[model samples]
Target chain A: MKVIEPHIHMIARTTHDYERMARMHTVACCEPAFWAGYDRTSARAFHDYFTHISQFEPKRAAQYHIQHYCWICINPKEANDLSLSREVISFIPEFLAAPTALGIGEIGLNLNTKNEMTIFEEQVELAVKYDQLIWIHTPHLKDKLKGTKMMLDYLKGHGKIKPERICFDHCEEHTIKMIRDAGFWAAMTIYPVTKNSPARVVDAIEIYGIDHMLVDASGDWGPSDPGTLHDAIFEMRKRGHKEPVIETVFYNNPCYFLGQCEKFRLTPDRPREEAWA
Target chain B: MNSFNKQAALTPPKNASELLDIYFLDIRSALLESAAALDRIERAAGGKDILDDPRIQDLKRACNIIMDGKNNRSEQILLLLSHPLE
Candidate 1:
């Protein structure tokens, strides 16, 4: 079955990870701008980061027959530096036009700080202006619930924001309900350490069902592995989920969201409503 | 469709006895890796009592959840280890 990894940091990974993903039938992967294990010094650094993901990563993934797509934004972790963020956001529009660039993404609060929210709001405006799809990164661990709520409430009240066009990733059991209930997509990220495991992700799928759900490995520089996504697929198989159900979560759901951008090429095998049925 | 109206489309999984037949080796490998890690931790502690450490306590709690035979063991163990408020 074909898989679509909707959230990962490929700049921090090597070609071997790409090869592994290709072998596992990952037809396409999306890399949202993320923390590169440390804070970058200036907007110029973010420019280079954005350029690499947009200009370079696509070529790298094409060698393995995997379509590479990216999102542009000043990530939440670095959003605290307002001057640097403004500088980064200033150039985001140019990259947003790139063929592989999906939209403003992985953009949300890092610490639920006022500065982060301000930048997040600014980026939301940017996305709306450009008619781009959005991908979000909710804060980790203890701050997640409040951080998710904070973004949800803001977007819900924004009047112009369309929940269907946005995705809030790294959702857990506690946060999944609110995200889905709000008509936004909820993505569970599997990690080898320090986040949702494959089993836990599968459990959420079992409990919450698969509508508007996405699963990603979130492989990065930290202790994470791309295989976690395949592990979740395997977990579902072992639990006796039908192939169509697995396809809906791991493949079709991502296509439905990311495909909102004309740049994303994959189409769902079945209509979303039929898959849900 | 929302969580309230949809459920995972799944048939019952293989019985535990049948599952063991297919996954025995994988289970054994995981247990062996855990045991090896615990052995290394104990040796590195140099006889100092670190059993009461919070990390170890969490591991123990996780193990208890594993043995509880609940269908949602993964969710229970994850909640025990996660920082999110349940």
Candidate 2:
């Protein structure tokens, strides 16, 4: 039942949710760089927002006994506002040393915005400078396919950037293989309306094997959950997945990514419960 | 809770997918109360701190609204996270 949720946004989550996940045996969380845009206005506004993600959110998650670490980046949808993007970027370095601040992430393109590309590139450079991992976000709508390819194109040419130090998010049927082939971890966000489901996530693991697969709820401003990661694992078990394979996808792969954190702790193996045992 | 919204007799949440729309808005309401209590404490402590007192005022104005909004949204998230969209 051990798990490591790779893309939860604790800023939108409550402490009770964290306690439930911790007691359910969640080991760690690798939150991607995300926007708390429910009401954020300017770059100065997002400056405080990033600090909350890097500082307050993890502290709250810890109170529930779960290790919560996050990536820092301005999302592509906000790229059109260069002022906010620039301000958020400047604030990222200050959060690098926080025990739970994993990397520069959740950065990528939307609708082929040249402005988004610029923001993504600058953040990527920041990621490289701090020697932290990159958490990339592919577009979620009609332009996703094109945006995915463009994001990969940008990463491919960087001489000092290794593809292995990255996690590509919002991956679906179309983008999964491409991101995997490029040597990045694939994180499937399980949302009811837009992203993959608990069932689909399990199916993806069945097809991809446990090498570098991770799942999360992407619990942002949308209808999402901080506990869905655990629910996905349970659904996988009910669907006939072996406990060993389930544990690896839920715990092992996510920990592998968040292990990049300076404060990572070793996860221990536990026996799975059987109905008749 | 009404019958349509109340799945009180429904099967237990065997998985995340099963918990959708079946709220413990009951739980959300309770948590919101405690969060409100904390805000009152913060405002009390910070009395007259900004622009003669704007920071404290903003904190108070923000308190009740954020509590209600977060709880309502938490329910939406609980449903969305548990189930998959076609």
Candidate 3:
């Protein structure tokens, strides 16, 4: 069961996590540029963070026989600082040219604030201009429904950013329908303490049917555990979902969505026998 | 504890309704514990650091969701458990 972790903060994780993920059959993983647990003081900070994820992290993951990819952005949490964000966004294209750079993401609202939305829209335009994939982080808890609605309305109204090229992540039972109905890809993140659990994610898949759906760990500086993803896989198998169904949701779905970027080399139908060879 | 391994070996629920009920209970319990932990951390940190801490921000978000009465998963769960394929 080869997997592609569509969203994770690999820079915050140790190399041992990579070893575990590889053992669990994770062929690849993506690190989206996000808030580094603190507000960085300057664009130079983001420059270094991007470089670490893009350059250093891949080398680290490769040592475990896992290919690492990443998304670049100011991240919604830091996008509130307009001046700092502008400085950071100005140089994002330089990192985008890197081989492992996939698209602009984990870039949506934090507090659902006006500035966050402003930066989010600008980044969407940036993605559009550069013809890049967009991965979004919707607000959590009470704000999730409203924030996701706001993003959907904003993206739909813009009318130019293709829905298929964008994925709204951290979707829950409340928000998945609207996201899928609106024709955009939807992803659910599994967490150890705070967010969706494995069984709940399986419930979402069972109900919604995995068309454009994806599941990831969203593992980061918090108490998240990457193992929750495999737990979901195990949960699905326990629920009698066939191997093909599990493969589609965990492997094929991410490949289908992320493969829109030419840099993502794996495909849903690729011969598994040749994976290690 | 090896409780996860034990739980993994448990039999699958007979139907979507049963599955939904189990998942809702599990998720509810996890969220409640997370909320309680966050409350303790907030009290110890004295409210000031919550504004700057991203982990605290996530904790606050999760806590807010758990506290919201209107954010119940029962309706969605019911719909899924009932239709199972809509």
Q: Pick the candidate with the highest TM-score.
A: 1
Taking the tens digit of each residue's C-alpha lDDT, what string does model 1 give over A86-177? 99999999999999999999899888899999999999999999999999999886677778888998999999988889999998876888
**Per-model TM-score versus the true fold:** 0.84, 0.71, 0.79
Candidate 1, B33-74: lDDT as tens digits: 998988888888463477778889898888888887477676
Looking at model 2, the pairs that clash are A192-B85, A224-B77, B50-B53
> How far out, in Å, is residue A114 in model 2?
0.7
TM (chain A), candidate 1: 0.98
lDDT score, candidate 1, position A163? 84
User: Candidate 3 lDDT, tens digit per residue, B1-86?
Assistant: 11111111223436868767646887789678876876777677466676568656554555555456363544333233221221
lDDT of model 3 at residue A192?
Answer: 66
The alpha-carbon lDDT assigned to residue B75 of candidate 3 equals 35
Residue pairs in clash, model 3: none
Off by over 4 Å in 2: A267-277, B1-86
lDDT of 2: 0.69
DockQ of each: 0.26, 0.02, 0.08
Tens-digit lDDT string for candidate 3 (A160-222): 878888999998777787887778888999976446878778877767776778999999879
Root mean square deviation (Cα) for candidate 3: 9.5
In the range A157-225, model 2's lDDT, one tens digit per residue, is 777777767888888766777777777778888988677777667656655555656788787667888
**Model 1 interface CAPRI class:** acceptable
Comparison by DockQ, 1 against 2, better one: 1
